[model samples]
Structure formats: C-alpha cells, structure tokens
Target: MNGYHILLVEDDSMIGDLLQKMLVREGYQVTWEKDGENVLDIIHQIDLVIMDIMLPGEDGYQVTKKIKNAGLNIPIIFLSARNDIDSKLQGLTIGEDYMIKPFDPRELLLRMKKMLENQYGTFTQIKHVFIDAEHKKVFHRSLHQEVAFTAIERKIFFYLYENRDRTLTKEHFFDYLWQLEDRNPNIVNVHIKKIREKIHDHTGEIIQNIYGEGYRLNTHMKK
Candidate 1:
C-alpha cells in the first residue's frame, strides 16, 4: 500500500511542526496548515486531516461540520487541548475522531495509521468489472445489473472495490487522487457525495461510515 497523505491543521506552529515532522519520518506525506481560512480550499488534497479544535478564526468544529455537510467522506482527527466531554461529543457529532492535546506525536501517528488501514485495505473477488473512472459502474454477474457512477463516485467505488473490507481515510483517497500535493477538502466532499449516490443506486447498501475515522466497504455479499 502507498503511504498516506495527511493534513495537519493546527494554529500552534510548534505543535504543527512537530506533528508534521513525525508523520514525515513515519513515511507519510504531510501538509501543515496553520490558518483556518484556507483549510476548506485544500481539503481535497489530503487523505486525512489532523485538526486542532482551537484554530485561529473558524475553529475545528466549524471546519469539520462544513466538511461533512459538503458530503466529503474524509476522516478528521480532532487534536485539541479541550478534553471536556462536551467538546469530544461535539467533535464526534460533526463526524470527526477526537484526540486531546499535549498528546504524544507517536500516538497520533499510530491512531492515524490504524484509521487509514481500517478504511483502505485489500479487495475481494466478485464478478464486478469495467469500472468507469468518471462514472461509477458496477457489473454484478449474479444480479446481471450494470450501474453508472459519477466522477467522484467512481473514484470511491474503485478505491473500495480495489481495497474491500478495509478502512479508508479521507487522507488515503486524497493521496490516491492528488498525490502528496496540498489542495481543498471540498473537492473530496464532492467526490464522496457522488460516489455515495452511485453506490445507493446500484447496491442499495450505504457505504459504511467509520465515524470520525473514514469510510469502509462492506464486503458481505448482498442478497
């Protein structure tokens, strides 16, 4: 598997730099974003985002909410100094994984790695083939059905079907699509929404949301 692309959104330069370095040393591509204003613009470039709840302007909660509402399936890990239950719950409500600040950088990396691994793993053998990268297409032999997919929809399906039964982080998807470059999360959201629609149209089973982690492909054969 390829290394993950990470978005480190922290206002504190020291913390951000430390995390960035750690992630880099671990062989993952890291993009450090200190400003909240530009976060939305580049949300699509990374596989996952390590966000600080206390940002300069918009803050992490608001950012997370926007990402989810936009239909992006990228996983967010909240790294904040606030350890209160309410804060944690709020972060979770917005579909982000939470981590308290003054935390070990190594631990953060481990959590991120685990989260990505869970979402994007390995593929299973099913008779579906000929996926349209721009349009989601799934051909099932048993059902004798063929479905069309949107661009983003196709990417998600291709990623999942290629790595079925595994956890895939938003970071992983971004890396696959944009490599290690920095971009916007909104781009990811656009693709995820399209992909979800295509999946529901054909399979009828909603792509499993790992909750604060990312998305997963349910390999259980549908009847």
Candidate 2:
C-alpha cells in the first residue's frame, strides 16, 4: 500500500499542481500530465487516472472512449467545471466518475480513495511460503527458512507466481529470463526443471506443464 501510483491529467496547471501536492501529502506517487495526448503512454504504469473533462487536443470523453476501446480497465474520475446533468451523463456513459470543479481538494482526494477502494479494495498479503524476491529468503508463515535459488530459478518462480492461472509461453519466459538478448529455449526448460524440484521438495505440488503452452501453478492439485 505504499506509494500507489496515480496519474492525473488536468489541463489547468494550478489545479494539477494542487492535486499533485495533496496526493503526495497523502503518501501517493503522483504523475501529473497536462495534455491528453500522452496519456495512453503512461496509462499502464498508473493504478488509476484523475482526468479532467475538458482537456487540450481531445476532450475527456474522447480520451476515455479511446482508453476503453484500447481495453484498459484502469479506474478514472472526471473532474470538470461543467456541472450540468448532460456533462455528468456523458462522463458516466464513458465509465468515469464525474466531480464538479471548485470542489475541495480534500474531498477530491477522498473520492479518489473511494474509487480505488471499490476497484482494488484492501489487498491482504498472502500468508504462505514464498521466496523473497530481494533477499532470496524463503518465508513460511512469518518464519524465515533458508533456501538457495539460482538467478534464473528465481526469475521463473516470480514470473509464474505473478501470472498464476495463465499459461506462459516459452518466448515469454525467454524474454524475462534473458531480456531482449537471444538465448536458447533449453535454458528456460532447465530453469523450469530446477524450480519444480525446489518447489516439490518444499511443498510437494508440481508446477504443471501445459504440453505446448507452458507452466501453471495448479491450484486444483493440493500440496
């Protein structure tokens, strides 16, 4: 919950600055963008967007439409000077929460908090054994257990856990394990084998291979 990234797209410099200050004071990582054009570029990095209805180049409605068309599910809140029903309806039609201008900064912050809460709620840390990404320490119900993991083994484990139910391709593994640099697919297979052995020794559950696709943590198969 530390430093949740927020993208604020406001044409007014003063309002955007104030919003950034308020969010930063509340311990949020704020990325303020004044134009609507560059919004899509940074959309992936932010958890949510605080958008103004009237923006330069493209209006908020058009921006929101494009975002939805692109299949991005990030929550958006519309802050605009237009307080008419039509404006509110338009914003809501495009899947945005509309708030009038001259609103209190604290209240705006609260609205943003509410939207985020409704979307992601409060995430509870999973209480299970996991190899710590940074320290490489194995954690089992708050107890630190010693476990050795090679660089590639750690990468593969983290990738699989990050994408739990989804089947990852060998290309995806190669990209993450070896970056954009070329590497043999056998390297991915070797790392997968090693990871399976370690996880099996500890938990006795196999990371299932999907024949042609890749691997998955088979939650249906109990440890």
TM-score of each: 0.54, 0.56
Residue 12 lDDT (model 1): 91
Candidate 1: segments with Cα more than 4 A from true spot: 122-223
Query: What's model 1's TM-score?
Result: 0.54
As for candidate 2, its clashing pairs are: none
lDDT, candidate 2, residue 94?
85
Best by lDDT: 2
lDDT of 2 at 12: 92
Q: Write the per-residue lDDT of candidate 1 for residues 1-223, one digit (tens) a residue.
A: 1335688888898888878777877766677988668777877766688888888888888888888787877888998889889988988878558888788777877788788766643223232332333333564321123456656566668788777678788888888888867878667656666666644434434456687877777656542
